[model samples]
Target: PHYYSLLAAYLECQKVGAPPEVSARLAAMTQELEARQRTALGGLGAATEPELDQFMEAYHEMLVKFREELTRPLQEAMEFMRRVSRSSARSPSRADRCAISFPLA
Candidate 1:
């Protein structure tokens, strides 16, 4: 269950901050995720219980953590976009616009 454990640890890292051992743990987790993916979707597909549960839990947990982390970045980006839109509507030159333009024709 080293792989499974590594995945949990990776989730913890992303939630807080990548731990000192995250480098090594992530490497292991990557391999494990790959193996599980292959097994689940391989040509000779066979439903696995324990392995599937572990991998699915890791995957779901990772995604949830990722989404949580992205909340701030996404909000910031949206705010930036709104600012840019307002700026562009107010003034073209100071709107963070690029001078380069190409004609489709």
Candidate 2:
């Protein structure tokens, strides 16, 4: 959907790269890829089919592996946020204090 929106914007801008037919084909492929990404965790509708169940299992395994890889960065971000909050609480005028605060519009 987002890809299609991008393609629509491109057509409106008349960038003149791909012809309409070729662009439509590419957009369809992009839509398929986007659908795959959306269902990477596999929808809950039904895994009645054998192949669908296997694919879902594989996708779940991949998600676990991805989460394992993100552990360090996730932990570091939490720690960093905690440190920033602590330092900001200690001094309101500190240069990094604004990192935790947003100005009201």
Candidate 3:
């Protein structure tokens, strides 16, 4: 799930014309994270219940860290894109102008 989100963010970076190195670095990090997850899951066989609980707790911590690390670059890229868009003279597309319609309570 996080891997897919990273890929989507990388694609968005490309769509917004972020630097080549930025996208490349993000792709590399995503691959590394996925590899780590695969390795961790593969090592879980034959563990006792208490050990499994500890492993899960540690895995959860790792996921939180991974999410924080992955989001920072994407957030920076998005903010940069927003700044550029705001400064440009070109009008936004119709899709950009459209607002979400919420159902009344």
Candidate 4:
């Protein structure tokens, strides 16, 4: 939800020609999210033994599912980009091997 909100705000900022304001808003949102995360983590120390165990179990399950869902697509995309980069280069340079190439705007 916050990501969507931030994206919408960015689009709106572009429409309004307020790029600097978008940066400010993004920075503010990042700080707010960090603070929220810190607060939630601080509260975790107060959880009962059973609650902590349950929370850890759920978190581990979520991490496993997230990695399973994301890993393959991410690897495939990275490989595709690498292939594209190599194809575009006459000879893949040392720098190209260490860096993911992106088309310049």
Candidate 5:
């Protein structure tokens, strides 16, 4: 779910013309998070109760770091899109300014 969410946001960032470096970094981070999840899940079957508890603790910590790493780029992309939308709204295109004829009701 997290991966998909991030992927969607990354794609949106690209669509909204966020910086290439920012999008690339985000894509890399998303892939890294997915890899970590896969690795963690793969080791679960071999863990004893105590080890499982330790793994959970470490996994939680990793998630916290992952969230921190992912948040910055997403925020930057959102801010960029906000600015873009604001500017676009402020400056209408020539077509946008043209009057549309409507039939009288």
Candidate 6:
């Protein structure tokens, strides 16, 4: 949701086509988002836990799924743009190497 919101706001700003004032507002919004993320992640030392190792092992699969589904497409598009004035495309789509591992002692 956050990614999509950011993309929409970005594309909207782009479609407005960079009048100087609009560009300044977009830059401000970008900074605002950075500040929000930083504030959200500011607490760590006093956090509580219930077997973090086990929770993390469970969520590792979730992280991989989210990264593949959400982040991978954006990464691919960025790579393609970096090639030949956006004339090139992604090399190939590879199957994800999904794995299963038993959590243990």
Scored by lDDT, the top model is 1
Where does candidate 4 stray beyond 4 Å?
Answer: 1-31, 37-52, 91-105
lDDT of 5: 0.63
lDDT per residue for candidate 2 within 1-105, as digits (tens), equals: 233334343333332245778767767766676677567536564335777556656655565555456565767888999999998778867566556767898
Q: For model 5, which pairs clash?
A: none
What tens digits encode model 6's per-residue C-alpha lDDT throughout 12-99? 4352435678767777777777776666567563354657645665555455455456555666777776874544334332343344
User: Each candidate: what lDDT?
Assistant: 0.64, 0.58, 0.63, 0.58, 0.63, 0.55
Off by over 4 Å in 6: 1-16, 44-105
Best candidate (score: TM-score): 3
Q: Model 1 off-target regions past 4 Å?
A: 1-42, 47-52, 91-105
Write model 1 residue lDDT over 1-105, tens digit each, in one string: 334445554554454435558756766766777688666565674556897778777776776567578566867888999998998788867435766668999
Q: Which digits, one per residue and each the tens of the lDDT, describe model 3 over residues 1-105?
A: 233344444444443344678867766776777777677667765445776566666665665566567668878998999988886648766677886789999
Compared with the true structure, what per-residue lDDT tens digits does model 4 show for residues 1-105? 133333333333333323577767756765676677567666655435776566666655565555456556767888999998877776667686789878999
Candidates in order, TM-scores: namely: 0.31, 0.30, 0.39, 0.35, 0.36, 0.30
User: What would you estimate as the lDDT of candidate 1?
Assistant: 0.64
Clash pairs, candidate 2, are none
The count of residue-pair clashes in candidate 4 stands at 0
lDDT of 1 at 44: 71
Error of 2 at 19 (Å): 35
Candidate 2: what lDDT?
0.58
